[model samples]
Target: MFNWKRSSVIISASVFLLTACGGGGSSSSDTNNNPTPDAELTAQQQALTDIANAVIPVLQNSNNQALSLANAIDAYCDEVAISSANVASTLATAQSTWQAAMTAWQQAEVMNFGPSFDGGNNSIRERIYSWPAKSSCFVDGALVDYDDDTAGFDINSQTPRRIGLDALEYLLYSNDLDHTCSTDSSTTSPTNGAWNIRTDADRSLARCEYAKIVANDVAAQITALLDDWQGAGDNYFQQLSTAGSTSSRYSSATEALNEISDALFYLDTEVKDMKIAEPAGISADCASTSCPETVESTYANQSLANIKANLQGFLAVLNNGMDDLLEDAGQGNIASTMTTDINAAIANIDNFGTTLVASVTGINEADCTNSTSDNRLEEACALHADVKKVTDVLKTDFVTALTLAIPQSAEGDND
Candidate 1:
């Protein structure tokens, strides 16, 4: 289950967007093909609809980007790579490139990392460590140890070690932190020697957990921003609902929006700083020739896992916290300014489905705890275009829309 609070931000905003259209009418842009009703809505409807107009597109792009990136990684993994060194090199390159991207992002912004940005210190254990022996993100009812396609065999079966490795490493933005697969089953259990590229003991699992620490911290940052906005929304609403004149709503909302704007900018800064990097010493061991690559990988996996656990824990907490907030809303604690129609818009976000997230299960491969940097270098690439997309939209388009929807009243007083 995705954290409801975080998820609700989208839903709440989205709901407002949906109902914000002109009173009785549909969008002015709808070529429709099928034109429906037409009439100006109340101030509230206009407001929500305006918000929706700006929000949904951002969500759609960001979510899809993440999914696309995951699928690409899975597709690459399905192709049996040329060799272990090749996989390692690929991992190293990707790791470096992605880190660069993160750095570039952070550098481009003015916010602090792991702090002002997104709770950069929160650790996410469950998010990163997945037991291939027991998990469920697969489409088929049950899954095999590495049987990515239980009933159907695709090109992915031939994937290289690196692709699987990267996916394992970056589970933070890719996998559904909530409702993680229920169990891990495979035709060839890695426990009984099926631990090669398709091992039941994947090392990157630990990396993912480690990354969760960063991701969770980032999520915290997101939640912080959301809270700030909600508070601002409340203030703005208070003025609108009880003021003798329209001045209070305009003034309060303007100030609140300014705070929200800062939060959004900071969120961008935080995300940019989240660097998905390999630990200091990735592979330090490996004198034994008899040691299967899988065994070496397991050692590496464990090592990274230990380093990342603290952060992962916090990630889970962030998710839980947001989920709790959503639960509160479910139990009837929404704002009076919000309408049921708006709620439905928020619900629309749930409609955003995922395939890569559902089709794959955690793969068991190299171990992390005792593996070497040379060995632990295994990598996979997850494109967080979706999350990035939405984040970008929140930063850009939504701001513009909100400004227009909640324009300052001529009679309002700011002092």
Candidate 2:
């Protein structure tokens, strides 16, 4: 969920580039004797090129999903403005569209280097899906101040917390019973009692408008990202596949490999540690018990699905890009082991009895320790251990076999 975002801190590409270039040398005469053909693709180079090619279509599909989500949100907002009677059905459709987009987003998260990592000030990734720092209070304030002309607030001016997928979750799924408009003017505000005394319909309309703005922003940002990656002449995909070329960001094939390999740590740090361990009370952040409120997509009850999507994304990157190279390097066992670990982790998440929130909501905090006999807590602990196995292989054996350096940002993250 929100945990994945923090794991994406930018690493210095120069360090990896220097390491990659250190071992390679050829004299001018040697190069002249055997001028490498422009079209020649070494095993590692070919694997990276193939990965770049494969990612284009995956990103295209994700952009399409984002567009669909934006359209569905707009449609739902339009309907809410007209008739409140079918709000439930319309909201359901909108939520479904959001889920589809979320699925694609989770997949794209695995490939979160390059275009997604803007330097300094602003980040495209944050614009699309800021979480863990989500603030419903900000969303509530935006809705309450929708008509405030002096505030000059629109979705564009809203903070990350107020205008991303999490905000939409709050608007769509929270307190569904009170979502409908009430004719009575004395009803309390759904978000907080201090807000204006508007009818339920008024609140719904405001929330719908905010949701639409957030959806449109997400769609626009994703479209721009896709363009940066695959657009006509300004394509970064070519830059990635052509590492060591003058125009590419990476100075060697191994540098590019390092970037992709570093991305795998997201599964270890964010998914296993922040997403599951913190909530399961196995990590330092959670001192004694499961923290249901820390779970992502809690309002939508889609935390389990998010975890599965993350594993699916990780598997895609490994299978599509690294498997053949690993086999050729005599490290095929590592790939197989990682694949099995990811699959088993997905199964653990699937078998977890209920929604993340429901599973931890009423459990005694004292009984939520890692060794507690509580079935739900125990299952959660087991899932964390399972994911750790995958990370251990990737961070240690995989990096060594490939001769790739772990990104500095990911170093020393013992957990």
lDDT on C-alpha atoms for all candidate structures: 0.28, 0.67
The positional error of residue 199 in candidate 2, measured at the CA in angstroms, is 2.4
| Per-residue lDDT over 141-161 for candidate 2, one digit per residue giving the tens place of the 0 to 100 score | 666555334246556666676
lDDT of 1 at 57: 30
Question: Candidate 1, residues 1-415: lDDT per residue as tens digits?
Answer: 2222121233343311012111112223223222232311122223222332232332333223333334443333333233243444444443443332232222112212111233222211111111222222331111232233323533223222212222333342333332233433333344433222333224333323223222333333333433432345553223322223353433343343343245334323222112111111111232332123322122223221221221222122212221122222231121211222222322322332322212112312234233332232222102112223333443444444334222232112111
Which regions in candidate 1 have their CA more than 4 angstroms from the true location?
Answer: 1-41, 71-80, 92-149, 152-415
Pairing residues by index, what is the TM-score of model 2?
Answer: 0.80
lDDT of candidate 1?
A: 0.28
Give the Cα error of residue 312 in candidate 2, in Å. 0.7
